[model samples]
Target: MTEHGRPSAPSLFDHAVEEIRATEFRDDLVVREITAPAGVAPFSLAVAADIRPEVDGVDSPYGTGRFILLHDPDEPSAWGGPWRIVCFAQAPLEPEIGTDALLADVAWSWLVDALDSRAAAYHSASGTATKTLSKGFGSLAEEGDGAQIELRASWTPSGSLSPHIEAWAELVCMLGGLPPGSEGIAVLGSHRSTRG
Candidate 1:
């Protein structure tokens, strides 16, 4: 080990971190470094991202997400590699759209599509998409119904790490209901068709 206890100076993990820092995301996305969860890997990094964070003390109505990169030189069997990327993204949705049976599948597909679009190579990907519906009760009855979609996924990543993070950021914005390449643009609303 090097003096720093790393296998070498500027280890692969360090390079990964640098790649993530240099990644470019949408102007509307606010990406901030956060504490990486301990005990998962010898080296790890994490970041939190929010779309349109806040304006005048009002929280963003878009969405929020987290990206975590873990590196274990041992090459964990499940990860299929020394590097693994885990992500979580959630967004509020129109109450009507939440009831759609295909929402979960579509949410998962978005993730795959984002990664493919960016040409990020990876394998051993697994994840789940969840939809939540809530209704106001009693004093809160006036609030009516609300819904949200959440996606959690992890995959072993190959090649340069920048594209993977970029894909993740894009996925977050997409879930927030923004079209591709929508940076710096104002969204009027999202339109969904009703099933009769």
Candidate 2:
């Protein structure tokens, strides 16, 4: 331990956290640090984000997501490196759009595209894209139907961490109905279900 007696954080982990804090997100996206999940690695950092668009002067969020950066000095075999990033992004979808057979594939593509576009590199990348549909019951029949898409992904990261976070933020915005490169524009209509 250092003379100060405080357990020193790994330099790589500290740098990663600093880079994440330095990254700038879209104006409409709200990001904040949250309790990182334990048992994933010796060091971890997590953040939560929401796409909050103004509707009639009220802030309405159409999507939300989480990003976690895990580091292990041992370089776990599955991770292929000391660093692994696990991300989750979910958003409500219009019933019609959700019914499309390609919806799940499209969601996965978005993640890949985001990473490629940012030039974030690594291997052992894997994840799942899930779509959930719900129909209101008797008492809530008037609420109609609803659908939501969720993507869970993890990958070892190489190079700077900035681009990775930015890409994930873009994915969150995309799933919220805002296309990439869209800034200062609010999404039209609400995907949020009246029931929930």
Candidate 3:
């Protein structure tokens, strides 16, 4: 314990933090570290990001999300290991796309596909994908209807945390309608574009 009387974070946890700090995400994402939730684990790190395409004159984001990493050296039974990753991703969807009945399943599949594509191994993984539809009320009827999709998931990490984090970032980009490897590619139909 230091002068503050709190137990110092473990060296392994420090290393994990360093790994996260060293990682670089896709250019389209605006990522920043945030305070982790207390009491969830002995050591935790969290990041939040917005999918901001660089289309000229566009200021709003396509979506936003958060990724949290939790580590407990004692190895929590429910997690199956010392490391756990929890993520939340939400994106506005085209009204038509939101009406699809398979949206939830598709969203969940995106996460699975992302992890598999990166070869990130894990178990005890579980999550929920939800689609929400909203219509303007009496005072706001001119606003029209809107829809969104949200994905909340957590999983155990079998090896290095970098891949898992990368996969999560990919999933966020996917939900935001940005195709994989879209870096440096101009986003068509962006607000700045006059194309119908």
Candidate 4:
């Protein structure tokens, strides 16, 4: 029973469904490919899912990507009956940027901005910031230091999966910092790198 008046993709149970936003997703994100289970942590969110979005970056040597849209159960004991929308973003690390805290701060903002930009209503928003730095060891040799950013988030959804997808789409854009989904990928020179 969402605003669109649809009965909701079968109530996260009746059958497998490809939940979607009015706007289509990027090729990098295969909608039907995502495979998640019913309920993640505790409250049994059952309607959980996942998707991936990628893009060319600016400062880093490599491109960028994000693991968008994960919904799960929040522990009843910890949060008092709330669902968690967990999200993760992975992007190329720019050389010597935001050494102290701005990076994490900006990262969190992406989630908030994503949610706000789409007008996705929800309650009790909270999440964690994680950045991993690991270089190839003796056996696992590599060219240079390996660095990546992971943004994990979970919140209680106020309504249906529609708003969630809208918010999730925004997060994908924020993580990759891509323009509106309408704009196609431009030439390297034309497309300024948004690597952060």
lDDT of 2 by residue, 1-196 (tens): 4578854558668878999999998788888898999998999999988887444332245888899999998889999998999999988888877788999899989989999998998789999999888899898887799888889999999999998999899988988888866777767447467322
For candidate 2, the TM-score is 0.89
Extract clashing residue pairs from model 3: none
Pick the winner on TM-score between candidates 2 and 4: 2
Best by lDDT: 2
> Can you give the TM-score per candidate against the true fold?
0.88, 0.89, 0.86, 0.60
TM-score of 3: 0.86
Candidate 1, which segments miss by more than 4 Å at Cα?
1-10, 55-59, 188-196
lDDT of 1 by residue, 1-196 (tens): 6877766523778888988999888788889898999999989999989888775233256877899999988889989889899999988887878899999999999899989988999999999999988887899776677788899999999999988898888888888888686777774243321111
Clashes of 4: 3
Candidate 1 lDDT score at position 149: 85
Write model 4 residue lDDT over 96-161, tens digit each, in one string: 442446777887887787777777777667777666555555766533454445566666555555
**Which pairs, if any, clash in model 2?**
none
Off by over 4 Å in 3: 1-9, 53-60, 186-196
Candidate 1 weakest ten by summed lDDT: 187-196
lDDT of each: 0.83, 0.85, 0.81, 0.48
- Models ranked on lDDT: 2, 1, 3, 4
